[model samples]
Target: MGRFNFFVAFIFGFGLYFYFDQSCYSYFHKEASSITKSTASGHILAYLITLIPLLITVLFLKKKEINVLEAVGLSGSLTKGFGFAFLCTLPLLVAFSVKFSLNTGLSLNTIIINTISSAFFEEIIYRAFLFGILYRCTRLGFLPSVFLGSLLFGVAHLYQATDFVEILEVFAITFLGSVFFCWIYAEWNFNLWTAIFLHCLMNLYWLIFNVDDSAIGGMYANIFRFLSFFIAIGITIFYKRRNKISLEVTKTTFCIKPKDR
Candidate 1:
């Protein structure tokens, strides 16, 4: 019964997220395209509409202090997690800012709103809710969970993509991004804050400084994106090494028996 409950939770949560996401995206696209003057209004309404799932996710988290920060796992000691996440993203951030710089005129307020909204809803849905429930249900190893979760995350991005080639490219890139995010969340012991931070930085870069392939051709831009992928893998390797060493030291200390105290 317990295991079955987990399965049900995973399906329901994922289905809910997909439903709300597609609905909001479709509505916003239609509104934005149909009326010239409705662009801003459409966007705002869409943002609000997307918040419904987030609200449900928060209620589901069920912590006594139910706030966004707490529900999203941000109310922890972020000193180390923030530093690592920032460093991991710094290279790509610099590359995008220098090479793209397409939408710098976007107001700081708009950037903040989009960053917070996107990071919270998406991270909680994919990483916290879906991944968490799946891991519990399957009891699979970390790599397996990450692969399945990330694959779903990548697939979710296919809704708006019209071109077949573009869909493939988006899925491939987002799959890697999902792997990186799941790794980050695990590194922080399932703290959604770290994932949220890194994700926001990534989207902020693209949203504020969207890639202009004419300026930096597709091949070279892909190279830059791949660099970030390699860095994420490096971080995971480093984390494993560090944890192994810590475990060895702790085992040795345990065997010492306190010097006959």
Candidate 2:
């Protein structure tokens, strides 16, 4: 019974943060007919409004031990965790920025607000909440947790596309990106702060690059994506080696198991 309640809360929590937030925000925005498009203030307001229910749900959960700030991966030392995470992600962001050309006309206020809000909310739901639940509550291993979390993350982006090919493209890109995000979280010992910074930089890069426009051709896109993927894989391998943690996935669960140093 207790486990059943926990499962229900977990599902509800995901729905509240992941599924409902954007839907509610869109509905209210349309009904009010005040904001024609997403402004900085509007984005902030929507995020805050949606955040309320998630926070409430967290409060009601049986395991209050899940420290959100830490789950967001901010718990580690600033120098080691935050700085390292930022520098590690910097190259990819820089490359993307150069490739896409910055949109100077885009408001800095909007960029900053959206980056923080998005990093906070998305990481909270995907990494901190969903992945955390699987990591902590279930017998699943790290890899499996990441795969499932990333899978859901990919699915959540489907609404952005109507075409089948575009949908597949979006899912593939997002799923790979989520895997990278999960790797960061794991590399930092499941600290969400590490993942959050990476996520923020990625979002900022996309925003600046004008994601609506495909600035590069297929060959270039594939090259860039593969390069980024390799970088993530390399980093994960290095982190595990340096920490003396084994990346042995269990056969039964196909989960990531990090043997401690």
Candidate 3:
């Protein structure tokens, strides 16, 4: 990775580490005990901290590399874009009740925050910059690029905790999702926004359905996860066979540059 990219990753890693150490437990405890105190201040700090590297990418590294819009798969049919977005989340909705047995009101905020902050920031860092750099250097095939990129994307989530099991869980799940995101972006010619939108929906479903029991509920969710993962594979293969485009070109988003004015 370039020095700039490495620096950005450092900033993201450190920021999340600090945020979790300082405030996450209190935040969770407050929720469990039914405390009504507003954490707006803390959340703001967390967001600002999280946004540092993302803003840097947006302002600097983005154009130096792939266009931000192209990184996450935006260049495609609108209907297909929306369909992919919704298909990703259909599992979550089907697995769990929309209205909860009890309401925490965390769903809206989770979706909003995750969609914008986590989804956008992560795509820029993990997929756009990371994958873009690797592809630029190696010109590897689609599978190689996505595999390495998604692994890093998921590996970075070890920030949530140092515990081995927790880390493994995060990596397993996040890695799988990162793979899916890579496919989605490929479908949309690396449109980061569409990827972010679909990512938000996918994670939103998980968060909402998992409000009470992520561990146990995860079993059920895993069923859907496996189904969706395989389904994505099928679609990816079908398009590969049907379109006759090289996976390399798809990974590169097939951005066509105009002649000099």
lDDT of 1 by residue, 1-261 (tens): 365764565566557766886767777746764674554445645655665665575455434545655555566566765676677778878887677757857875567556766676678667765554344334444555666678877887776466787788778878877877765675565677778877777677667676642212276566766676678657756776887732212232222323332
Point out where model 1 deviates above 4 Å.
13-72, 136-138, 212-217, 243-261
Worst 10 residues of 1 by lDDT: 246-255
- How far does residue 72 in candidate 2 sit from its true spot (Å)? 4.5
Question: What RMSD, rounded to one decimal, does every model reach?
Answer: 7.8, 4.5, 7.4
Using all chains and alpha carbons, the TM-scores for the candidates as numbered come to 0.67, 0.74, 0.61
Q: Write the per-residue lDDT of candidate 2 for residues 1-261, one digit (tens) a residue.
A: 275777788677767676667669876544443563545556667666767776666556524566655544556665665566566656666666666666777786678675777776788777766676566555567676777678888997788666888788878877877877776676566667767776776566666765453312255445654565566568767878898996633353355444441
Looking at model 2, residue 122 earns an lDDT score of 81
Candidates sorted by TM-score, best first: 2, 1, 3
Model 2 steric clash pairs: 72-192, 72-193, 73-191, 73-192, 73-193, 74-193, 142-256, 143-256
| TM-score winner between candidates 2 and 3 | 2
Show model 2 residue runs off by greater than 4 Å: 16-38, 60-68, 78-82, 97-100, 210-218, 246-261
Best by TM-score: 2
| Model 1 TM | 0.67
